[model samples]
Target: MKRTPKTLLVLALVVVVGMAFRVSWNALRDVARAIGADHTAATLYPFVVDGLMALALVATLVLTADARRFALRVLGTYTGASLVLNYVHGLVPALHGASVDWGRLADWNPANWALVLLATSLPVGSIYFGSDLVAKVLHHQPTPAANAEKTVESVSNRSMADQGEPTPEPRVVNAVPIPRPVQVGFLKPTLPLKPMPAIEPVPARPASTVAADSVRTRRATGRVPDVARSTRPKRTPGELLQEARAASADWPDAHLTADRIRKTVHTSAEKARGLRDALIAERAA
Candidate 1:
């Protein structure tokens, strides 16, 4: 056992032993006086000591919850005997005195003092243990008012819980796979330079000479030939560049590829690349 409980148990035992000793000592002294053997000046009647013991025994029985029936019967018999003795002792003195000497009969000896203390034990024990017993009985028997209040409280709690907002379930989303970015080279050219073809100086022909040659050729052929009619229109380098610039004005320098320029400007890939370079140069300037 723990120290505190152990100490309390020991103290309780000491108190019970002390009360037993007090009761015994008083009873013994009363017995001695009745047999004409006691030397003390104390003059209390023998019945007084027994009466106090009886009261103590009754108190013990009342305080004990689980006392056996046989034990209770024995205590009851003893208490009845003590009460009868007390009445008989009191009457015998009164009969002899004609007028009872109450003071001398009930004198305060040490044993009587102890007996008085033992007698008072009943009320003290009854107050403490009797209240506990009553409280236990009350606890076992439930009240309707208390039960109704509990029912109301439980219903209100359930309602409040139901009315409370529901927590949202957490969303589980698949993580998007990020595309791996293309790594660019720092030294790569944004616009490629195209190789320009060598230009030969042509001797200028007079307008009259050009007109005479055209007329003579037409006369010789009767009309323009199918070969001449099927030939594509030849655009100047300046015209090709202007068309490429207009088509790719919104395109970044790096995005202006030869194929993109050819599609937009309707030109050869080489000429388109040259035009794209020219457009990039113009933008840089």
Candidate 2:
């Protein structure tokens, strides 16, 4: 594995903690022995104090939220206890190697009683705190059900990729074609038909007279007269309806609105509305 900065830092911390623990171990064992513990109890006393502190520190780093707070409390308690014990061992020179007069400090002496109580209670406290700390750590770990779900999802994705299956595309509906307005012209009658009056024919005019008249007319008006154009015949309502139906034959039922139909068939709004209603009713039927 690559030796990252974090790895190197952890290694350095481990070395520092190991050396510190070794030094404290001797001091704590001596304190236990000085407090009237047997040889076997003195041998294991250091582990109860220093070992629990290490476990609490590890739990503090591993846990989160409330569990981390609990681990921190455990770590602080053990650390303080270790500090007090080590300090007492240093202060009382007899705890190092010399034989001490235990009978001189009677049960009535508060200092002697307190020291004995702290030394004796450590093992029981370690058992309780250590078990609770471990339970908290285990409780915070991912559940088997969650792990199984994640594993299943990953396996499914991997299998799909290995099979070279393409992701399905979304369905697209076809768009309706909108029709443009068609311009139609119609001629209106202004007057009733009348019989033509009989007239006598005049002699043919000479080319000169015709040319002179055309010149004079142009001079008077400054332009030639425009010829009249014929008007287109009007379409009946039936024809208009037929045209509207043909234009909207492919249109969707929802698109058959009055405005759209009016624009498409070049008809009046009222007529378009009627056609729209009729088309919709026919489709529904």
Residue 50 accuracy (lDDT) in model 1: 44
The TM-score values for the models, in the order shown, are 0.20, 0.48
Per TM-score, the best of the predicted structures is: 2
Residue ranges of candidate 1 with Cα displaced over 4 Å: 1-224
Q: In candidate 2, residue 123 scores what lDDT?
A: 87
Q: What is candidate 2's lDDT per residue for 109-187, written digit by digit as tens? A: 8877777777778889999999999998888874478789998887787865575878799999898998977654354
Query: Which prediction has the highest lDDT against the true structure?
Result: 2
lDDT of model 2 at residue 193? 52
Q: Flag clash pairs in model 2.
A: none
Local distance difference test scores for all models: 0.57, 0.82
